[model samples]
Target: MPMSITLPGPAPWGFRITGGRDFGKPITVSKVTEQGKAAMGDLRPGDIIVTINGESAAEMLNVEAQNKIKQSPGQLRLQVERWVLMGHLCNVNLVIPNRPLAPQNCRCLHPKPIPLHPNPSLAPRPRRCSHPCSSHPAPPPIPGALMLPSPPGPVR
Candidate 1:
């Protein structure tokens, strides 16, 4: 589900939307000015812009999206898709007997292509609980999932 975010307008909405001129690329929220006009509006980096002022963003080029943002009247209404790291890319099953906790064969579940971070760090292999009671190791992480802040703590 896309979220609708409205911010007071005029020039300098305090955020920027960026995407390549490539036809299928997504118009993503590239940057947000901290403590600026858009900061309090609940906008975040990497949110995909779906519509601008009720106009389909997919129909416009990157330049057009920039123009629409700059031309907002009183308020800027944007429909954006938030990116979810977990439960977005693939399904993970930790208990694969005789094999690595996470396998590289997981398939991308999304039909539309999502943009990745410009520089993604490789995630370390998941840790298995040495406690004998736990039969399986931790679930494997996606390739660049090092961004995960902390473990979920004791999975049962």
Candidate 2:
């Protein structure tokens, strides 16, 4: 299994952005960080980061411009929109494995298409107990063990 990592802030991928608080401002690579290389794994540079872990990145920025707003500081699932020379392209999902910067001036690429099928459902089952507690008490004492405890009546 791959070890997970957390981003301190939202890092920018290579790409030009349009429309937003920073509308008309072009988001470029090598400006974000020294490790400005496009994510070698899934998302490439210039791909706009849209969301992290299902939460909309734009919405998150609206709430707080800090990258720390992520519920947990760890590997983040990102949703982004890739702008191609052609018209708008498909929304891509990316993963941020380290600390990222706040995307105050950036915009989420776009949301990806979700499949129509609903998730599989299963009935809830009772959980098993491993320790002794309320539901199950200790076993009763042995019957004959109590009969042997009495002492002689003080040398009467």
Candidate 3:
């Protein structure tokens, strides 16, 4: 079951959304702009949107969802569900009022990516150099095997 809510917007939705996970997958809330209508309305990350304006969000593609949001003016309805602790799901009902976001007050939802470092525990350990003649050990000679001194001529 999905929770439904009506959001009144004067400008944009102030949130980025993505869909098309598989077939019939609900649109997911990727990011919520700070101090925007979505943030003020209590929308968060990982919210699976099931419907928009009474239309099935799961049935719509990613482009469809974007188009729907773009075409919608004034008010927009949404049905979303969020996963809570202990594998339980909580339905959220939000009525976001779209107001003109001030440029100075608006914050970016997409943050800069940070470089990831490899975990020390998962990193490969360096091999020890034990051979006396060289850093690496030489291959041992196989018993009961013939060793060729020179290369053999090509057979006709």
Candidate 4:
């Protein structure tokens, strides 16, 4: 889901927007300075700009998008497609934590809820484990879980 983040600012916006014709990819947030306006807002590194002040980001050139943001009155309302939803925007890796890759109830480590679901904010990830599997049954998998597609092959 696209989020509308209101960045209260004057200029610079404390962030950078890259991509579009200048970069040969969709308009994406290339950087967010720490403790900056954009950092304080919901903007992240891989967020793809869907709209800027209700203007279609996909339709505008990079320079045009920058101009729109630059000339904004006070606040900038950005409609951004999150990396989690768009899947690896700006060549960023979808981090797979060091959790057990084993199946549920397989005498492996306790399964942790994969927070990379529809809304990651809902599920906070557990801390990393230093030891190996505890020789216990893995927690039951979540129904309708996002499973990685099997390797390509002709099903015999």
Better of 2 and 4 by lDDT: 4
TM-score of 2: 0.29
lDDT of 4 by residue, 39-109 (tens): 99857777778899888889678898889989988889998855221112122222322222322222322
Using Cα atoms with residue i matched to residue i, what is each candidate's TM-score against the true structure?
A: 0.55, 0.29, 0.50, 0.55
Q: Give one digit per residue, the lDDT tens place, for model 2 in 6-123.
A: 2433344322223222443222111133344234333443444455455544533322323323343444454544322100112322211111112122223321221111111321
lDDT of 2 at 7: 42
Best by lDDT: 4
Better of 1 and 2 by lDDT: 1
For 1-156, candidate 3 gives per-residue lDDT tens digits of 344656678658788887654544568888889988777776666667877778877777788888887788788778776432110012311111111111122122211111111232332222322333232211233233222211122110
**Comparing 1 and 2 on TM-score, the stronger one:** 1
- Give me the runs in candidate 4 sitting further than 4 Å from their true place: 85-156
**lDDT by residue for model 1 (43-129), tens:** 777777889899888767888898889978889999886533322223453222122233234443211122222222332233443
Candidate 2 displacement at residue 84 in angstroms: 1.7
Sequence-dependent TM-score of model 1: 0.55
Local distance difference test values of all predictions, in order: 0.57, 0.28, 0.49, 0.58
Output the lDDT of residue 133, model 3: 22
